[model samples]
Target chain A: MTATTPREATAPAKSTRGFLRDNALSLFFGLLFLLALGGQAAAGWADLNNRLHTDGFPPMPFGRYMTSADFAVDVAENWQSEYLQFFLYIVATIYLIQRGSSESKDPGKEGRESDEEQLIGAYAKPGSPAWARIGGWRTALYSRSLGLVMGILFLLSWLAQSIAGRAAFNADQLRQREDPVSWLSYVSSADFWNRSLQNWQSELLAVASMAILAIYLRERGSPESKPVGAPHDATGSES
Target chain B: MSNRLLAVPLCALALCAVTLSGCGAARGPQDAAVVAATHFAAAVSQHDGAAACGLLGEAPRTELEKSAGKPCAQAITGEDLPGLGRIAKVETWGEQAQVRGSSDTVFLSHLTGHWLVMAAGCTPRPGDPYDCIVTGG
Candidate 1:
C-alpha cells in the first residue's frame, strides 16, 4: 500500500476545486475589462462618427475606428494613469505609514522589513518562491518584482499614449488646416499634459479617498477594510 | 511563476505599441493623398472649375458658394489659387492628410474610403492656422 503524505493528500482536493472557482476574482475582473472595452469602442466609434458627419466627412466604420489612433490614445491614457496610481501605491506603501488606514502598513512596521520578516534566504520555507530561497541579488530583485512590474506597465502605457496621441493630434491638425507638429512637440504640448494630468488627478483622489475612508469604514468581509467590530484605530488589519 | 505570467502580457503590450506606432505615414495612404491633391491641382490648372469643385468636400463647396454668392464651380475658378508644381511632401494621420506641393498646400480627409479636399490654396500664417483660399466650415 502506498503511503500518502499530508501535502500529497491535500493537493488532490485543492486541484479538484476547478480553475474557474480558484481564479474567480481575476476572471471576474477580466470579464468586466473586456466588456467595458467593447462598450468604449462602440461609444467612441459613434461619437467620432457624429463629429465627422458634422465636419462634412463620412462616418468611419467600426473596424477602422478600432485601429485608429483616436481610440488607441483614449484607451492608453486611462490605462497609463491607472497603472501609475497602482505603481505609486505599491512603492509608497513600503515606507509610508498611515496610523489607521487599511491601505498602509502599521506605523511601527514602516520601511522594507528584514529578510527574516519577509521569509527570504535562511528564513524562507521550503515551499517559498525560488528567488526567496536563493538569496542575494535574485532575492533582492524578487522582493521588488511587484512594484517594478507595475512601474514598467505604467511607462509602457504612457509611451503608447504619447505615440497614439501624436497621431490623433496630427489628424485633428490636418482636419483644421493647421500644420502637424513633431512627436516631441506633441508630447510637450498643453494637450498631452492636460490629458495626462486630468486622469492623474482623478486617480490620486481615488487612492487618497480609499486610504482615508478605509480607516473609519467597515465592509464586513472585504479584504480592503478592517473587520466590522475592529477599532477605527486598527491599522493594516483585514477581515 | 506569477512573474513569468506578468512577463507575457508586458511583452505583448510592448510589441503592440511598437506595431501600432509603426503604422504612422503608411506608404499607401500617403500615395493616395498625393494623387487626390494632384488631381485637384490639375483640374484647377486646366480651368475645369466644375471638376475642381467636384473634389471639394460638401461643406467647403457650400461655404465657397455662400461666401461668393455664386455656385462653387464659378466662384472656385475666380479665386486667386496659385499653380501647384509637383507634389513635394505628404503627411497622413488617421483619416486626414496634408499634401504639400511646390507652390501650395492642400488638406484632405478620407471620407467613405475616398480622399476629398477639405482645404486648398493654403499658406502658412505665423502663430495661427493656415490662411486658405477655400476651406470647409
Candidate 2:
C-alpha cells in the first residue's frame, strides 16, 4: 500500500506564491534596496539643503536634488565597492582556502574541482543548465560566469562612480572658488582613491570577520555558519 | 539549476544601470547657466544694479562692494558693463560655467539651487582665470 506524506496530501495551491516564495531572498533584498535608496535621496536632499542654508543659498527642490550628481555619486560609490567585494570573493574562493573555516572549501581542494565532480558536460544531469550541456565556449563561460558577471558589474559601477565622483568633486571645487579638474585628473586625485579605499576597507573587514568568525560560532540554521553542533574544525559545511 | 542564481545579480546590475541613466538623460546645467548670465546682462543693461547684484554670486557681490567701498546698488549700476550679444558658445564644468556671447564672456557658478554670475564682462587673460570688470572673489 502506498503512503502519502503531509506535503503530498495537500493539493497544488497558490501558483502565484510559488515564484515569490521561491525567490524570497531576492525579492526581500530588492525591496530593501529601493527603500534604502529612497531614504538616501531624501536624507541627501535634506543634508544638502541644510548646507545651502548655512551658505546663504536657496535650498534645492526634492525632484531636482534626486537627479543631482551629488546623489548619483553617493549611490555609485557604495555600489562599486559592494560589487568589487562580491567579485573578489567569488573569484578568490576558487584558488584559496582557510582550513577550518566554514566559508572556505577543504584545504586540499584549492582550485576548480574536476569537471566530472562539477557534473557538467557529459556528466550533466537532465536538469543541468543549457550552457553546461553545450560543452564548448558556452560551457566554459558558464563555468566562470558568476565571477565574470560580477567583475563586469564591478567595472561598470566603478566607472559610474568615477564619472559621478568627478562631477560632485568638480561641483565642490567650484563652490570653494577653485578650478574643476578633468575626469582623468579627478580619478587620479586623492579624493577618488580615498572614497574608494574607505568603502573597500570596510567591506574587506566585514568579509574577513565573517570568514573567521563562522569557524567558532554556532548559528543553528544559517548557511553562512556551520551547523550549531558542528565541530570548530569542520570545513566546507553549510546548513 | 545554478544558472538561475546568476539572474538575480544580473538583473540587479541592469536595474542599477537603468536607474542611474534616468538622471544621465537630463542635461540642463548649461542652459541654466546661460539663463543666469542672460538675466544678469539684462539687469546690467537696464541699469538696475539691485537686480544685477541679486544675480551675482555671494563672493562676487561681496567682493565688488568691498573693493568699491560703496553699496552694490551704487557701485554696479555705473560700472559701464557691456551689453551681451547673441550667444556664441557655452562651456559647463561641474557647477561652474562660462557663457561666451558675440561680444562678452560671462562666468557663472551654480550654488545650491540657482546659478549666479560669478563674473561678468570677462575677457581672456592668457593662461589665467578670466579677468572681469565685475569680478567675484
Candidate 3:
C-alpha cells in the first residue's frame, strides 16, 4: 500500500541515529573542512610571523594575521580554483565525451537527454521533484541547478580573489618602497595573473588527471572507477 | 521552495560583504601609516633630534648614526633636514610608507607600536629605491 506514496516520497530516516548514519558523508567532510581550515590558519600565521621576524619586523598576533590581506588573498585564491574545477567538470560533462572514462557521459548520449528520459513534465512520477513536474522556467532552472551553483560559486570566489589579491599585492609593493597602483592596474598586472594562472593550471591538471586516469584504472569499489571486471572500453556506468 | 530561493541571494550578499571587508582592511593599514609618518616628520621639522631618533627603528637609527659618524642626536640635527611645512601626501602599503611634506619626503617603516623613520630627505631615483640623504640601519 505504501509502495507508491504520491509526492514527497523517500522521507529522511527519522530516528536520531538513523539521521547521523544517513548524513555521515556530509558530516565527515564538514568536520574535515573545519579541521583543515584551522590547520592552514595556524601554519600560515606561524610562517608569516617567521618571515616578518627575518625581515626585522614585529610578529603579528593570530587575530590580526587571520584578517590580513595576505591571509585573505591566499585563502580566496585556493577557493576560486577549487570552485572552478568543480564548475568546469559539471558543465563540461554535459556535451563532452571521453571514450571510456566513467566521469564522462555515454559516448552517443551527448547533448541534453530527452524530457521523457529525464523524467520531467508528464514523465515525472508522483515522487519526482515539484519543479520537474511543474514543467516551466522553474523546471528548466532546477534541471541545471547543480552546475549553476558551481558556476556562481566559481565567479564569486574569483572576484573575491581579485579584490583580496589587490590588497595583498599593494602591501607588498609598499614594503618594497614601490608605489601602489589602482585596482584596475593591479588586476591587469602580471603578479595578479600569475597567481591566478598558477592555481588554475594545478586544478585543471588534477581534474583532467582524474578524468583520464579513471579510464584505465579500477578503484575496486569506488564509484569514480569502472567495476573490477568491467571492460576497459566501458563508458559512463560506474560500479 | 522559499528557502531554496533565499539561498541564492544570501550567498551573493555574503560575497559582497567579504569584498567590502577586504577593501576596508586595506584602508585601515594606510591610515595607521599616515599617523606614523606625520609624527616622524614633525619631530624632524621641530629639530627635536632626540624625539626624531626615538622614532627611528633600531636598525634605521643605528644606520643613521653609523653613516653620520656621530650619535643620533648630534648627527640628526647636523643634516639640517629641509623644513617640512606640512604633510602634503602619504603613500603607504603593507608596512612601508612615504610621507611627503611641502619640501621633503621621508620613508617610514611600521616596526612595533609606531612607524619609524627609515629614510629622511628622500627623492625618487627612478627605477630604484628612493635616494635618501639619511640612511636607516
CA-lDDT, candidates in order:
0.84, 0.76, 0.74
Off by over 4 Å in 2: A1-13, B1-51, B57-71, B78-89, B93-96, B99-106, B109-115, B119-137
Ranking by DockQ: 1, 3, 2
> Model 3 chain B: which ten-residue window has the lowest total lDDT?
B1-10
Among these predictions, the greatest TM-score belongs to 1
| Residue A206 lDDT in candidate 2 | 89
Which candidate leads the pack in DockQ?
A: 1
**By descending lDDT, how would the candidates be arranged?**
1, 2, 3
Model 3 whole-model lDDT (C-alpha atoms): 0.74
RMSD, each candidate, Å?
Answer: 4.6, 6.0, 6.1
Candidate 1 C-alpha lDDT tens digits along B5-117: 65575455445554555364779988998888888888888888899987888888989999999998889888888866777878888888898888999999887778889
Off by over 4 Å in 1: A1-17, A237-239, B1-23, B69-71
Report lDDT (Cα) of residue B130, candidate 2: 64
Over the stretch A99-157, how does candidate 1's per-residue lDDT look in tens digits?
Answer: 78888887778789998889999999989999999988999999998999889878988
Off by over 4 Å in 3: A1-16, B1-22, B25-32, B84-88, B91-97, B109-111, B135-137
